[model samples]
Target chain A: MSAPKPSDLAFVPFVSVENMMRLLHRIGIPDALTGLAAYIEEDFRRWELFDKTPRVAAHSSDGVIELMPTSDGTSYAFKYVNGHPKNTRDGLQTVTAFGLLAEVATGYPLLLSEMTLLTALRTAASSALVAKYLAPDGADTMALIGNGAQSEFQALAMKAVCGITHLRLYDIDPKATEKAMRNLAGHGFTLTACASVQEAVEGAQIITTCTADKQFATILTDNLVGAGVHINAIGGDCPGKTELHRDILSRADVFVEYPPQTRIEGEIQQMPEDFPVTEFWQVVTGTAAGRRNDRQITLFDGVGFATEDFSALRYIRDRLEGTGFYQELDLLADPDDPRDLFGMLQRANDGAA
Target chain B: MSAPKPSDLAFVPFVSVENMMRLLHRIGIPDALTGLAAYIEEDFRRWELFDKTPRVAAHSSDGVIELMPTSDGTSYAFKYVNGHPKNTRDGLQTVTAFGLLAEVATGYPLLLSEMTLLTALRTAASSALVAKYLAPDGADTMALIGNGAQSEFQALAMKAVCGITHLRLYDIDPKATEKAMRNLAGHGFTLTACASVQEAVEGAQIITTCTADKQFATILTDNLVGAGVHINAIGGDCPGKTELHRDILSRADVFVEYPPQTRIEGEIQQMPEDFPVTEFWQVVTGTAAGRRNDRQITLFDGVGFATEDFSALRYIRDRLEGTGFYQELDLLADPDDPRDLFGMLQRANDGAA
Candidate 1:
């Protein structure tokens, strides 16, 4: 009962893309989404305990790679994610991510997992969780603008977490909407493919904009949106990339993930620096108002905070205890003697030689 | 003519610690150290091309976990590392690291390797590389303080790159020095285990301090370090953890990795904010003086820069093409139709079901 063996420390559990997909299906995507939303909600409730900062971003000519790190006192997590709009044209996913969760006491990685699928899941889960507190009561229908890689996840997470049963989707390209329609086929929802944003939002109480253009172009103009509708804005996530007109933001009471980050990357970037906004966690903690009235437009401008990723990782880690969806990776070098790193190398040479 | 398949895109080559040791043995440790030094030298020569930022650190009651990220436009690399002083007491490594290298344009990781061994290799490479420029000519003996995990690597790198042939080691714990002596037994050099710091420094032209402590420390005093000698100060990396006294810094012209990071985390942290320091790259680029005279005391105040990690990763990546020491892990999610991430997951679920 003295100490754990050093070789036992070499293994860090890793969930690959294939394993992540199996885990998602095994738990059922709907149940997974709801479970993930619970974790997100729990973390949001104790948001003050987190170390929050704007993600460190490295911008390039065609894309950006970002490292989002956060920690509670007990655990630390960071996500390595990249966004390249042109990647689709080259037959690659626009986003591919991986993340690690570590023990804060030892700074050792406990889990390393492919985050591309998990990120899409968590980003949608975050929206659904926020919608629970901000969306108008009895909001059963959602209008999904921009049907792309994340559209189906967005639709299902909202259905499972926010009780939105009907899905109306629209995109500038008919093929994107057709693809999304096919993916969500027979998923227990009444799905509609609309021609324009106006047609998509016609009978919807919640509108979600997730366009992917890295520009200031507006997917939703002021005239197109009516009052009493909750907007879950997920597409405008980087500087100079926005989906809604400034006029809509002026009229709406905006809620964000983290202010310093969302101010630069969210739709509210078009607003004045001193513009008033409420952090969504404050609403979760019951300190801030959410959906003051049915007629009041509530906007959740989410850039996807690090804590949501941390929550998703924490959830996956807890779920991996008995599940066979993870592989123990030889990620860290643990010498038999703590100070004998070179001796470990020497032994490896002897074994290999 | 067609796009790469999704499975192919998901496979990222990973070199585990055992493979890293195999590669080092294949390349020979001295040559590996020299090869890594060349890459480090190359990167230091064009230091401005890199996007240099201080590491994002998360401090806890126990230790710190840091993400050091840097990009040179064509490629991006980041190292995840942690330092916990009490880890050794629990039979865990005090420092453990892993890193990834990616294509800057696509943001796809090309290689993921265990950097605990690589960092140890690269830190020694950096010291020896700097010693090539700053250490006295024909210097053959080095006094190694704190002969712990990094001691033997430092001694060998100095032998390979700086032409040092003799080593004098000292440690408060004789067991650490004994461990180093055993690890470096077959390596070709004259080894001397000294009793004290004064005994260790006698007739040595180079001095290396690589201790592991969490508080303010003076491993090297002012009068103990004389003129015409080069000092590679590594252990004094974190805030409040400095190896040399302020008087030693006052007498020596310190060259640091990155000024912003060094001013906060290096030995220079003990000096005033306005204290004069030179970036080591200027000397590499021949824009600044390295060893001005035989009487000058030069210090390479290296707090392990991100570029050195980048270079080590770059080197390991290039060396992995034909080496059978790498495993391709399914680390990314790539959908055939880039817009249909749900379709990919659905197919995976169907296959698994």
Candidate 2:
């Protein structure tokens, strides 16, 4: 066979949040969620193919900005994300992100995308995917404590992935719960707005806590957790920020994305350095057990990994192929004679002059 | 006065490369170059106020990808750049880049820009700024030994900033030299295309080497040395990539960007770990010696730092304020209610329904 031409190389397609929402609107959210979950699960099974590293974080007075980069030999990906919880007061999303996917062989960016919406979707999908293996059999009801921007996605993802039919929502802000209720109204799920975290967790099989505060507030104390409940800890995802109390984690069989990063940023940070935890990939690969027994409480200490972003990026790139919503950006220079980049500029100048 | 409300915070302007070029074309490249030099010098003077770190790199099979992040309390910036020398063979530029500037207090991305072109301009401006401080007085001739895409920019920046009026250019690829010659025509500078590196360096006050290769080949050996020549080593910017001979670096007074990074990626990478070098910021701040005398050879190992990109970004942001060429990218979510991000999707769904 002849050598593959440059044009034959895979080009990573980018999707802006607007374009992504449009695609989701066309494809419908449930289908998108299902597709993303499938992609994520397939990637997780190939655990050792990835080159993983703890995200490089730069801390400042107000919040933190991080670069989470990973590669699987064929492709490289990274997310540029920031967290400033106080941003909500200023009408800004507490988390904003953008990321790129590049071909590892050529180091050429294939996609440059707005990742804010995709991040929410992927985070929820990851939780639901893990819960498929870890959650108790026939789990239907989930307690969504700390209802916020991500609560609706979490609710829908659980419903679409793990057969969750009921959502017990509670939030310190009544408006947050109301917004979630309204958002999930016609999604074919029963929603009950509870008065307290205890009320929300009382009879639910799965508990998801996704608060947006940038602190170590224990949104789920040990006394509130029940037996056989699978806790999807989503929001407490940075150094000095946590949601589940140490006692709750101590009693649960904890699972994490990447142990090295989760130990520093996840709810598992409250545990000791030698605390035993399973990498979610191992469980996905069937190398480790997810839930030991029906009475055991399981915790997925989710801090969002680069691998998940890579999977989500690939999914979006594949899904948005013929969609016309994405604008062609001249993000890279494609000169007829690449070494004559100076000539390209000269041609532009000549045309103008 | 009462504290300004959160909603009253000013929106930062963004400038993409297409719009930045429009701004440059309107103001003229000469004026933009002058303005960029001023901004770079000003930022260098206040270097201590900024938080600086060596760029984080992810190496792959074909090339390397890197993230350069820095902040100055009020604003944070990071650039995602990749270098794939083999890319030129496939009709793509060897390097591609983009960056972001964000507000520190809220962690909101203020600007997202296409930096592929801006990087060339900024790298040239930074090298020239260093030459202005380190090159001896009355230096008006430059030897550009690598006549690739960046060679003309280097030549022009040196001419505009250091008053260099004559250029001797050489490249292994004769087409590249011809391209540089064409690009430099009518740019108010005298130029000569030479046959070899030695011919290019003959009797010149400054020498710039910017070859596009990812290896440790020594383009400049001790035999080509001359006194009082300021060497701007541009392309030896990654580990295992060095253009200058060890003896050249050993004898010359080397000025670098961040010392830790330069030690690993610059020409000094060939030297011992303890080799002493002065950071360019010190020379800009007048805290260290630049050139002791007219006969002293100096080398500005131009590895390209994040701070220079920060300066370029700020300059572009300021200059492109009124230009209508930029499209408002929906890169960040500005939810009416920050906690109701899911509601935005629901509303979109409702509108479609």
| Candidate number with greatest DockQ | 1
Cα-based lDDT at residue A53, candidate 2? 89
Residues B1-353, model 1: lDDT tens digits: 01345457679989998889999999999999999999999999999999999999999888999999999999999999999988999889989999999988888998999999999999999999999999988899999999888999999999999889889999999999998888888788889999999999999999999999989988899889988989999993788788899998999989989999999899999888999988889999999989988889999999999999999999998887778899889999988888999999998877876
The sequence of per-residue lDDT tens digits that candidate 2 reaches over residues B1-353 is: 01334443222244554565566678776667777888888989999988888888888767888889888888888898888888877777788788888778877676767787788888888989999998888998899988877887788788778899999989898888888888888888888999998999997999999997899988888889799889999983789898989999888999998888898899988888889899888988889988889889999998998888899888877766666756566666556787887888767777777
My TM-score estimates for the predictions, one after another, are 0.98, 0.95
Q: Give DockQ: model 2.
A: 0.61
Q: In model 1, what is the error at residue A266, expressed in angstroms?
A: 0.5
Which one wins on TM-score?
1
The 10 consecutive residues of candidate 1 chain B with the worst lDDT sum are B1-10
Which portions of model 2 show Cα errors greater than 4 Å?
A1-14, B1-17
lDDT of each: 0.91, 0.83
- Residue B12: error of model 1 in Å? 0.4
lDDT of 1 at A149: 92
